[model samples]
Target chain A: MASQTRQWLLTNPPVADIKLSGDDATFSLVTKELPPVGPNQALVKTLYLSNDPAQRTWIQKDQDPERLYLPPVQKDTPMKAFGICEVVQSEAENLKKGDLVLTEANWTEYSVQDAAALRPVQPDPEHGIKPTHFLGSLGFTGMTAYWGLVDVVRTTASDTVVVSGAAGATGSMVVQIAKHLVGCKRIIGIAGSDEKCRWVESLGADTCINYKSKSFKEDLIKATEGYVEVYYDNVGGEILDLMLTRMKRHGRIAACGAISNYNNGNEKQISNWNEVIFNRIEIRGLIVLDAMPKMGEIMETLSKGVKDGKIKMTEESETIVKSKFEDIPSTWMMLFQGGNQGKLITQLV
Target chain B: MASQTRQWLLTNPPVADIKLSGDDATFSLVTKELPPVGPNQALVKTLYLSNDPAQRTWIQKDQDPERLYLPPVQKDTPMKAFGICEVVQSEAENLKKGDLVLTEANWTEYSVQDAAALRPVQPDPEHGIKPTHFLGSLGFTGMTAYWGLVDVVRTTASDTVVVSGAAGATGSMVVQIAKHLVGCKRIIGIAGSDEKCRWVESLGADTCINYKSKSFKEDLIKATEGYVEVYYDNVGGEILDLMLTRMKRHGRIAACGAISNYNNGNEKQISNWNEVIFNRIEIRGLIVLDAMPKMGEIMETLSKGVKDGKIKMTEESETIVKSKFEDIPSTWMMLFQGGNQGKLITQLV
Candidate 1:
């Protein structure tokens, strides 16, 4: 193993105008010697880094440190991320050298993580599922989609579902699950561009509407004529407002994220508060951590679905925007800009 | 039997400035001959009419006709209200003459309603609980409080419950139940005035804050030091927004009414929506009709509680704003103006 390890450290928080300069003060790439793995810990080499919008929220300077859902990434510390990793050295019985695992070990070429914090990736060659699926489809994002749809929104085949941020990592899983697995008759995806909309349509969504198009409202209204029963909201703000207007009585909204408000000082506001009350809608703000107790069962079902070919997970590596370790700072910005089509993966090795 | 009957009719819908003029175009008092009872129907006399905030929402001229929870009162027709009534004549086996009952019959001195729609009142002379308990503590408002608090908010003894519109009919019941029955650790009531705040305190709330006071924010913070675990919201607006800030992680909000939005074109927008996401809050909009299937059992439990003296319902009839039959139009206005203390009732007979 190399004696020197390189990691991206959060230096300063990003402002409203979130752009990375060549020598961006927000993040710094530094090389240091790998720390010795202690007992119950393993040294991991990150294979694929997962890019999530939640990364932006974690680095907010003004957020109350005590109230954050998870601890914020401290200044001059390696930013926390979920990634597919290979155990390079181990002192724990659960993990061994060359064993692939999923962990909060990324933005780094090498990491020393507690073995207990890692989840082993189940290799199912019969299904042709890659180990990276554990970072996206069969992982936290999939767990979020499953619980949000089945448990929170209580989706049924008879219902018409609407999903915002439909081409993104988490939202795309929700769109496919609602359509194919849950058997929802009509699944509509609201995305930003026609290219993203096309990607969502290719994943078996009934229809995709580009929210940026001039005919967005008309197209959405025409597409969801029966009204939305379940709205899996990955992007909140105006898209959520539009969905609120088109919701039927007793509609359920799974508030997954408000990516639109992440970098903007002027947070997107939802004005259709009346529709929620008048229609007796239930809006639940979900954090995947709340669904952790059901992880074992969730992973089992997800694995079976992938193996049985009941769940369609895009495996074309070309879809995952690959970047070198040095490009981590600029590449992370792609999450906010919607420049990354599928999951954005940074390959270290 | 009396051949003539006096009833209140809705003449026109109210405007942004919702006021009932003495001879208001919104309501008319008319004398009409009682219609004959049909099969499975009973001719009932309205003993006490319920003046609920929902009445204001039901009569909104701009509301979609199909979206009303219950059928809206037609122009020149008897305004619908819940009431404690006496069955004067019945063609149905379940109802008989002189049977004290609960009904969706009000504003009118007499109504011909389906027997199935009436819930017979349980008179407990032993506990000195009157049949009027059916309209307040044992009625739809009571059911709304019960389900909203117990079922929806899932209050526990460990919870710090805060209620808005604390002295209003439905809110008072919620305040009492969350404090007394559920035994929440800290119970705070948010009311509009000191007098209303005092009334809420008398019902065993740990503290009461007058939202109209300049020290409202400081007082609320001091009262709920541990933060609000469950918020039963009856008046939605700035008060709702204020509560959003003080909510703990996984806090539940039972949205029973948004009375503040009824009169103004400006609907209350919750600006601290990020708190909901970060704290993982769940806000459920409730309409009592959704709990109809649990009505029989809900009324039974409430009636028994009143009879057993386990539930303390303030029976100072003076606190109940009672008006003569012709004052129905003016009496309804008392609801919006916070003119009623315990419950607003119109005595038609």
Candidate 2:
């Protein structure tokens, strides 16, 4: 029997709100024969894929490579998805069959990728790190959180930190890190729903506000008391704009992800620019991959934190949607709402 | 002799653009009896008042003390004007008669103020320094330029710096400092007219574009080529918004003043916030007064720079309009246009 491959291809980049299906679908499901593994290449079967909020921005229309840190996903190609894959066949010296590795498995059932691109993952759990954790706390999601709060914002016991998207994947990690590990004086979380806020608070946030509430701006103001020393911003739009006015002089902002503005792109909605000057605040944007050289260092701290029970384990925070390849787009959309509060990932076996 | 003081009072703050005198006047000329000097106070006659673009923001309406670096000017008060003043009478041990001091002389011919608020200016010229040079180079105007370029953005020889309001007082200083002092390889300036651009270029800026011209944005794009390493922003809003996109990785911006939005208050204009993150840029706002502890040190370098001809001598750059105290408001409005292409001051005697 001829081997088969199933993958989702980005057919068009969205102009405004994203479309995953129908006539205006940004992505399409395609079936083809699995390509044979060539020199320095490995054939792999994707087990789990990251359904990232930033993934939508990666497929933005007319993405000027100059503007975007990562180039726009090429139209009519497999939509970029970084995931854990099991090596089915290998022609590279470093890899063998049945070995699980982390690479761009994408939204595909089987992929032939450069062996150099793959990093070998222990097939078995090491100190409670599951292979799916590579898509969760042990991966870029965790790395982003660690970098944003610890390295970027440099939160301390003296700081009053406010984190937007407190319930999402990277955000969830940041909340736990700032509160449980870093021991910040106050860690305020901004989430979409009251339940999500509650969950975020349980993770270690001092107080969490529902941004969708009628009195969100008022509540956030009251919560922060106009003394936000450090702001780890995950959702970029109105919340980020409001936070600008509330920051203390010389405040540090870790511009993580603008999840809310992922579709339209965060535009001219910000009004408190004068505050950025008045307060002498610093806003720094980061691509977590830029810190790949620090990966060993990050993993050491993150792994130790997890092992020491300072940071929550994958099973505690993991929110996975076991869905088919056809449902990847819809599954990705579901996480946008506050309903999916924990570390979001798609179990794409 | 019972003397009368001629002064300008901020009667109302503007809603949009400023109105100096009209049915909706923001300022009014008034004459009052000069109050007696009290203990720890000095009576002074204003010699020269700074016609600053930022002076307008100090008079902005409903300014929250929390939002503004300096408190807003209270309505029905002598409008704030920092200037060179002749000490006519003194009750403080630190001040004496005939001494010239740099202080809040207001838009008044004569006024009594706290002696501690005044810094005694040298009565005689030293190293070619004049009383007017205190307002030009040794004052807060020049201190703002030095702190912004040397400390805030920390521009190096390799930097491509863009300065807005390139013909204005602080901007003119920045153009000279970034070029002759810092020796930055390329410095582009944005002014409001062809004449002002030429003046800015003459002040050591590599090229100066007329922001009012039809090809302004295009010319700016072609000039910087999306590699603005450091931006000394004297004018904010659209130019700053555009610069957010044009920044290189880890670009730095020194937010000295936003003169263009001084009346409008730089609202809802910034759209390229994502670029602030994508490029890992850092923007810092400065209130030059915040660095007052370093004043003696700043004056030392500025004085030396002038003496060595590295920075322009006061006579070479001072744009003094000999006018009555009542003309302070109108003269200030004139500086907003690019015509006043030097260190602006109203020579009030």
Candidate 3:
């Protein structure tokens, strides 16, 4: 009997200044014989992979990406990402062949992962939840929201939280968590479009402002009423400055990511940081991976919310050619252009 | 008999971008009858008047000099400041004649103040401590150091603390508090000259660096070995930027005062603010007046430390001519040029 395995490879190296384009990229898919798994490792079939803005950070070579939390992905290596996978074969003591797992699996049809790297995913079939929930609400995005709000920003029921990038995976989760769990008095969400703003409002945010509109700063101030107690910042640059000025005395800011400056060669400098001193604000950056110890509590609460219909999970999936594994580069390009809604994934099946 | 009051006034209003000259200033000693003290008020005889860098901010029409901690001195009016005074008459129940007091009195021979405005000072006659200690150690400078280190910075015993302006009143106290009270493992102090650096070391700092030296940054880095956990910032600008780069992850910065930028027309923009976000640093500006509730605790601890010899107190006093009070504008001019040391007090006796 022969074993089955699949792999994706990057054909050409990316140029520093060039924006990823059709001629600049190629993806190659290969079917090869499977190798035996070690005692602590499991063979997993990729179910759902997360396509995050952070992925773009990995593909660009010229940028000095030294994030405190996420390890930078190496060029030409199997793209490292968090995904929900089904265990096809397992020699690990903690996992079974049929068990669903969440792990840092590569962008490929099959992955051989260390059992230690695999987080066992017990599906609550009674609640009718799908495996994709593990990649969104019950996964990294959910955990990021949980730690950034609870631990980093320390948002409370009386806090007025204004979150940017408010309609995406982490932002959406943050809005829901602030509304349902934190019981924040005012939740202002800033998204790129009216559609996203409406989507955020539907997810229990008190109000949603579209950054694409010319009146972003005015709308944000009016929506927040000049009293933002906590700012969950994902989008940096001018948006950050506007938020900094409107922050209340003793306001807390959780600097989760700077998606706005991720691709730009020149990082934006905040002109009014003296506001931090004048207002006596507390601003801290956080990465969810550093808060792994609290994942169990986060998952338990999210799972209960999902079962009770208090939390609504939405994902925008963009499927690309399986053999265009090289198109991973271009697929990621679509994200920076605001081409996709939720998660960007490629299917090999 | 008609009682007389001596007062100094800023006579020559400073023009655009010109240093203040005490010449053209005015001082008057009169035999006019003393004003009657109102209920809840006391007549205080000036003992020692405080002159600080913040006074320069008050002369400017642009800056809102009324800080929560320090009220701004009105132009051409008697120079108001924190002063050590002897109570000559008191209507309020808590105070009595002959008692030493600390209050926001002016540069004058006598000031009628609300009894509520005066804080009774308990003199330590055994150690030869005088009323001036109330202006330096037990006054705003002491409270500034106490609240900034204990509350704003949230320093721990295992942390390393770096204090800029380390030989100044508040900075000196900060170094002592961090070393003696908090038991910080490493305390690096930065001052203007080798003499000031020596003064900082005498205050129990583990190491002291003269910031005026060309190799200041290198010396600072070598002193802490790249582990600065808490930064008690008094002098901002370049020194602050240097500390920002060397701060440990999750470091806390207590922005007590930006003396370096106070006279620079408030136009100095800190170029290294991105470090605040990238390193997850927590920087908070503090006004010691906002920390009044902890005054009793701080006073008791400091008094005990003084008695136990765990803390040492020193004062650099410069007595200006009472007739030369008209030269206050020039005296203040000398402050920014680092002309005076320790507590700059104008004695009207």
Clashes found in each candidate (C-alpha, N, C closer than 3 A) = 0, 1, 5
What's the C-alpha lDDT at position A342 in model 1? Answer: 56
Per-residue lDDT for A1-349 in model 2, tens only?
Answer: 2278888898988867877668988888989898777899988988788878878778888878887888779889989988888888889999999898999888898888899999998633566778888787888999999987888767788888998988888888999888878889899999988988998888899999998899998998899885889999988878888999889998989998887677665467676777877888887787897788888999888888888888877454887889887788788888676547667778873
Q: Model 1 - which docking category?
A: acceptable
Estimate TM-scores for all models.
0.84, 0.95, 0.80
Rank by lDDT (best first): 2, 1, 3
- What TM value does the first chain of each candidate achieve? 0.93, 0.94, 0.86
Model 3 global lDDT (CA atoms, 0 to 1):
0.72
Q: lDDT per residue, candidate 2, B1-349, as tens digits?
A: 3378877888987656888657889888888998777899988888888888777777878777888888888899988878999889889998888899999888888888899899888833566778887887778888999988988888899999999988888888999989988899899999888987888888899999988899988899999895889999988889998888778888899988877677665567776777877788887888886778888898788877887888876454888888876678778788776548678888974
RMSD of 1: 4.3
- Colliding pairs, model 3: A26-A326, A27-A326, B22-B330, B40-B115, B41-B115
| CAPRI accuracy category, model 2 | medium
DockQ of 3: 0.26
Per-residue C-alpha lDDT of model 3 across residues A1-349, encoded as one tens digit per residue: 2277555554443433334445555334566676778788888988666677765555555333442334545555566667778898888888887898888876776778899998877776677666766776777778888899999888999998998888777888898889998899989999889987887888888999998899887888799775789999887777887787778878888888777666554443454555566667787877676677887888788888887777774433222324244455556556566555544454434
| Model 3 chain B poorest 10 in a row by lDDT | B61-70
Tens-digit per-residue lDDT, B1-349, candidate 1: 7667898777777655564665556777789987778899998888877888888877777666655666766777778888889999899998889999888886788888899999888776677777776677777778999988888768899998999988888888887778767788888998889988898898878889998899999999888776778999998877787788788888889888888877776442665666677788898888888888888887777767666655676564224545678777777787788787766776653
TM-score of chain A of 1: 0.93
